[model samples]
Target: MQTVDKALKLLEFFRTDQPEIGLSDLARLAGYDKAATRRFLVALMGHAFIEQNPASRKYRLGAAFLHFAQVREATLPLATVVTPLLDALSAETGETAHASHYSAGALIAIGIRESSRANRVHLDPSEILPLHATASGLAFLAFGPAAPLEAAVDQGLRAYTAHTITDAAALRGAVAEVRRAGYAISNQGFEDEVVGIAMPFFDSSGTATGAIAVATPASRMSDELRVLILANLHKAALAATAGIGGIPAEAFVRAHGERRAA
Candidate 1:
C-alpha cells in the first residue's frame, strides 16, 4: 500500500501546472528518490498509466487516466435516474432492456429490467461491456469522439462468438450503417444466444457518449421484431440524451441530416 501511495504521489507531479516533468524534478516534487521515481514510472509505463516523451525525457499522464476516470464515473449514483427508462423499455418491448453510459473508456450498465416473456435473454444490471463489442458499442462508435472510435478499431475486435465481426473494415461498414439508420443492431456479437439493438445518447457536444439497448433471445425474437425494438430504443436514447442536456434540437437535426446523406 505504501509503495502504491508513493507511486500515486509521484503521478501527482505530472498533474501540476507544469506541462511535463523530468525524472529528477518529478522525484524532487514528489518527495521520492530519483531511483524510486524511475521504478514507479517504469511500472506505470508497463500499464500505460504514464507516457514519456522520447526526446524530452519528460513524463505526462496517459490515456489510461481517461479509462480510469470513466470507470469511476460508472460506479457513482446513476441508478435513480436510469431505472425508470429501463423499466419502461422492457415493459414495452417485452425484452431484456438496459441503460448504459460511457465512462472513461467503457460502457457501464447503470440500470436493467428483464422481460416478462416466458423465456428471454437477460443481462445483469451490474455487468459492463466493452465500448468495442456490442450493439451498444456500434451505437456509441457511430457517434463517439473520433479518436476512441478509431482506437477501438485499431485495438482489433475480439471475437466474442462466431457471429462477432473481427475485421476492421467490416466493422467500419457496420458503423456506417448505424450512422445511416440512426441506430445499431447486433445479432449475437457478445452472446450467441442474445441479439441486441441500441441507440446513442448524444451529449452536449453532439457526441454520443452513452447508449441504451434491448437484448432478446435469438430463438424468441424475429428480425422484424428486432427492427421494431431498435426504433423504440432509438427514441428512448434520444429522450435520455435530451434530458441530460446533451442534445439540442439543432444538433439532432444536423446529425439526422448527416445520417440521411450518409
Candidate 2:
C-alpha cells in the first residue's frame, strides 16, 4: 500500500503546464529517497504508466494513463453530456457558463461556453474550483457527499481574495446556507470581479456528480439580474440532470417546491 501510494504521488507531479519531470525533480518532489523514486518510476515504466524521454532523461505520463482516462470518459462522457447544457445556459443568461466534474475530491472544469458578449468571464478546461472559494465547489459541498467537504476543511482553506472564506466554521455555515437555498452563490469569492451561482446535479444513483455555474461580472450583478440568472440556471440544471438520467438534490427539489407553493 505504501509503495502504491508513492507511485501515485509521482503522477500528481505532472500537470497541464508541466507535463514532464526529470529523475532528480521527481525525487525532490516526492520527498523520498532518490533510489526509492527510481524504483517506483521503474515499476511504473514496466506497467507503461510512465514513459521516459530518451532525449532529456525526463519522464511523462504514458499511454496507459490515457487509456484508463479514455475508458472512464467513455463510460461517463461528462463533456459530451454537459456541453449542450453549458451552451444553453450561456445563451439564456448571456453570461459565461461552465460545468465541472468532481474527481478525487476536486472540482475540475470539464466544459465551458463563453457568452457572445465581448466582456465575459473566462474559464479554461484546466481550472480547478477551490472548495472554499467557488460557487461550483460550494454547490457540490452542499449537495454532495460529506466526506470530501470534511476532508477539504481539514486541509485548511486559503483565501484567494478579500471575499474568500478562510475560516472552516464560516465555510460550513456558507455551505449550510447553500443547502437551504437549493443552490450556491459566490460573490467575489474566487475572483474579485466575478459573481457566480451554481447548482449540483446527481448521478444515476442519486449521488452528486458535479455542478454547473454561470459567472457574471460583478458590475452587472443586481437583484433583478441575480433572479434572472438563477431562474435560467435552475432550468438548465434540471434539464442537464434529467438528460444524464441523474437526480437533483432532495433539498433543492423541496425548496423549489416550496417556492412554487409560495
lDDT of each: 0.77, 0.87
Please provide, for model 2 over 49-155, each residue's C-alpha lDDT reduced to its tens digit, 9 standing for 90 to 100.
99999998899989997888788778867777788888988888899999988887789888899989988887766667888899999998988889988988899
Q: How much lDDT does candidate 1 score?
A: 0.77
Report the lDDT tens digits of candidate 1 across residue range 1-262. Answer: 9988888777645533575888999888888888988999998888888889989989988789788767755664345555787888888788988878886666877677888887988775445576556998888888777776788778878888998888888988998787767777888889988888888877678888778889898887786787568557756877787667677334445655675566
Top model by TM-score, which number? 2
Candidate 1 wrong stretches, greater than 4 Å: 1-78, 248-262
Using all chains and alpha carbons, the TM-scores for the candidates as numbered come to: 0.66, 0.87
Positional deviation of 24 in candidate 2, in angstroms?
Answer: 2.8
- Which residue pairs does candidate 2 place in steric collision? none
| Deviation in Å, model 2, residue 237 alpha carbon | 1.7
